[model samples]
Target: MRLSLLDRSRTRAGRPDAAALEATVARAEHAERVGYDRFWVAEHHAVPGIASGTPAVLLAAIGARTSRIRIGSGGVMLPLHQPLVVAEQFLVLDALHPGRVDLGLGRSVGFTPPVRRALRRDVEAAESFEDDLDELRGYLDGTGPVTARPATGRVVPTHLLATGRGIEVAARHGLPVVVGGPVLDSDELPDLLRRYRRDFRPHRDSTPWVTISLDVTVADDDATARDLALPEAWALAVSRQTGEFPPLEPKEAIRGAERPAQVRRRVDASLDRAVAGGPATVRRRLDALADRTGADELMASTSTYDREALLASDRSLRDLVA
Candidate 1:
């Protein structure tokens, strides 16, 4: 399986959010130097913890800084914007960088009701995702009713950042699917993926491909690796309790802080799901995951407050997979 990185440009406590964007570009440069196959960013609107909201703009910045690494949106939420505009934005990115762009789409409307209103989207907006995806593809392939400009004849590969139903959508469209989170632990996952491959209908030579994404952190020892995973897990736990995701705090700070029993349990559960350990430990877990899911690629969507440790983790994960 190939290796890739997905950076959400997570904000850190006590720092300007804009700094996270710069850090994302630097990390992409490092990912390229270390031979990562692809570098993807995410779209998260009006989220305090995440700095990136517009993936295409951030991807443009990343593409200008790195030469060879494949730069893409780990996804742009299809329900939040017009399909033609999304197509044109990525088309422009492809024109500047040429073959290195990818467009990963998702159906998430927003993080909260207010966010949804701000984007002029409601829960119902997601219902049109399939139709929008078809329309967007038409523009990318030069088959839409109105052609999207900066039309470079090149097709920017589209991937679905999918869940259960989204996987079926991808299968119907013959596109690659990226799955993670609770779905990875589901008993029905293997069957779902098998069905996806079996049911896939080819679209212009497209084939069914699956990329498993998760938080994979590596350090010199098991304890140290888990420590690196703590910030992200804590942030997740807090979000579940408080309904707001905050900037990542230092691991030591997270460890020393007080927490309610429920939050503690959630944190422990999140840690249990993450693949974090020394080289041999992570390798064994990844092998099991690959065997279970028949994953074609591993997109390590890891994050932490300490930038240097995160970089070391990225390099270590690349070596583990390569």
Candidate 2:
């Protein structure tokens, strides 16, 4: 039942204005004080609505402001960057924060056609993920010498954010993995967890950790929870359908937009993945999901308009973990 904050820093209109950045940092600070185990920022590029295009830099900022809470990417989109550079960036983070860093890597490009072309990533590049992961490990383990001095002898554990065969790669490397999204059900995740546990070998220790991030929102009532979650749900749906990132609008506004029927379907599906309700209802859902999946840790990402309501959602999660 360990809890953490997952921030996307979504702006309402593709603008990460000064106010949004300030609010995000403040939220991270509040999360640390309120007993969150970690603060994970997502990496998205060329997405005007998301402020966290460079998660490593943002994590460094968050790390400097907080003492105990772990700070790292919810995941770094691996296909977009060189593994060595990523290793070095995180190596410095480990050097500064010691045991308080987590590096979660994901294989998805997370961008549209033009952006993917701009990044110069071919479809085959994703296949190199296994090689890149090994190279990163080699750099960290002191076996690779070129540009590897920073991370050598470091104990920073790396986790893979996987949906498919990437899970097997994580198991092979003996790293913890996080499985997410709507295609994953409570029943499916436990089997993956078992596979990881059975296959894991100790890079430095005998056992591996498993964590999952779920879209969640807790409010004083179910109606309010749904209301707060609409923006996030809509944005996710739009992203999925168009392969583009856009700022969220009110549900009523969305209904008025010239959206395709398929887009509406996608949005509905996104809403289904989100758990939104009062504290008691949310706790019941979470406990059921936990029992079903046996997830080692549960991280929550929320989208609420009001600062107070957002903080309340976080506080509710803290109480549930307690």
Candidate 3:
């Protein structure tokens, strides 16, 4: 049960400003020292709450500050960018960091229709994701005719971040694949893993790797842990329902506010899926999830408000899992 960090640098107080950038960078540096296996950031365009909308650029900065540990996107939304550009950008990252880069690709749009259109994505673009993925692979492998100079002949391990049918494509290509959020049944995961492992045709390696990301937050006491984690859980639920990034409010504050019963129900539902408690409780839950999923790696994204609480959760996780 290797642990990694998934950062969104979500704005908690109100507006996302320069303070968030400094805090995120500091947190990344702290994560490196605290023995996190990897620090992966996400990309979300035009989202007011998420500061890491340009993960490649943030990753470059992170790579510069940290001496070791992997730095990469949890995924770059491939449908929104040109594959060649992605290849070139990541080629530079690999050149700078060498054996410390992981390229994760996701097929979905990270933004809504208006923002997607602003980024030049259309309905037809979604269908072209597989083509773009193949082209990116070819470009990186040096087999494509339009040779990406720095990337040519350079093979960086690529992972496909998938939600549904894209998992099969990832397995067929023999790339590592990541499954994220609200996994309904444990049985379905092993079946997906079996399909990936069975059908995988490795291009660079003989075996395929599978990683899963989940929401996790730990504290010394169970009540305190839940208290710290509730805000982001509520925010995620609201975002899913509304497709808009709302201002962050403390859990108690939100609960006190006048809101619909259905909205409260959604927030409670989000908390059910998230792992939050004392270290012992969290460890037991994680071990069970790993046992059920058979995931090679488990990455945790904490939605705690206090930075110290977040760091404590990371340390507690490493110690418990170790």
Candidate 4:
């Protein structure tokens, strides 16, 4: 399986968001240098912890720094913006970095009610994702009412960050599918993938493609690896309970603080699912996972409190699989 990255540019406890974004560009260069397949950025709004609210802008910055690696949105929420505008943004990106741009689209709504209002979008906006995609496609292909400038007749290959319904959409359009998160940690993903492949229509570009994304942290030893992952794990659990994704606390602070029993359960549940360990152990786990899932690609969506440890894990994965 090929390795790719999905960076959210996570903000740590003591760091400013500016640094988190700069770190993303640096990581993109490093990913290119280390031979990663693609460098993808995420989009998250109204969250202090995530800095990648504008993937198109971030991809432009990434495109400026790296020459060979593929740059893309891990996904743009199609429901949040005008289809014509979104198409033009990516088309312009293609102008800057032709043949190296990918457009990954999703149907997710805002993180909260206020965020939903801020986007001028309803919660059920995703119910119209197919229509949005069609319009976007028409604009990119120069088949829409008005020609989308700078990208007329130019095609940007698309991928769908899919669930059950999203998978069907991709199949109909002959596009690839990016699947990740809790789905990767479960027993259900393999069957779902199998079903997708079985049901895919034979469109010109439609072959079954599945890229699994998950949190992976590696260290010289299992204990330290888990230690590195503690902060983000805690942040995620806290988000579950509070409905707000907070900045990542330092691992030492996370270890020193006290927590409720419920928080502990959430953390344990997360850590149990995340891939955290020393090299050989991680290699074994990753291999077994791919073998069972038949994953064509692995999107290593890893984050940690310490930037150095996080980058080191990013670099180390290649040798383990080599």
- Write out the backbone clash pairs for model 1: none
Ranking of all predicted structures according to TM-score, beginning with the best and ending with the worst: 1, 4, 3, 2
- In model 3, which runs have C-alpha deviations exceeding 4 angstroms? 151-153, 184-187
Q: Best to worst by lDDT, what's the order?
A: 1, 4, 3, 2
Which residue runs of candidate 1 sit more than 4 Å off their true CA positions? none
Tens-place lDDT digits, model 4, residues 61-105: 999999999999989999998998998899999999988999999
The numbered model that scores best in TM-score is 1
Q: Model 2 off-target regions past 4 Å?
A: 147-153, 240-242, 250-265
Those runs of model 4 whose alpha carbons end farther than 4 Å from true positions after fitting are none
Give me the displacement of residue 274 in model 4, in angstroms: 0.5
Per residue, candidate 2 scores C-alpha lDDT tens digits across 1-322 of 6788888877665344555566678889999888988888888777866767888888888888888888888798777788778888888888888889988888877566776888888666788888888887777666765856465366567888877576678788888877777436645667777787889877667366767777788888988888778777777777777667777566567657787888778777766778888888898888888886677788787875566678888888788678
User: Which tens-of-lDDT digit does each residue in 170-235 have in candidate 3?
Assistant: 888888888886542445777877788889888766477778887788888887888878888777
Best by lDDT: 1
User: Which 10 residues in a row give candidate 4 its minimum summed lDDT?
Assistant: 198-207
Q: What CA root-mean-square deviation does each model show from the true structure?
A: 0.6, 2.4, 1.8, 1.5
Q: Lowest summed lDDT over 10 consecutive residues: which window, candidate 1?
A: 161-170
Quote the lDDT for 279 in model 2: 85
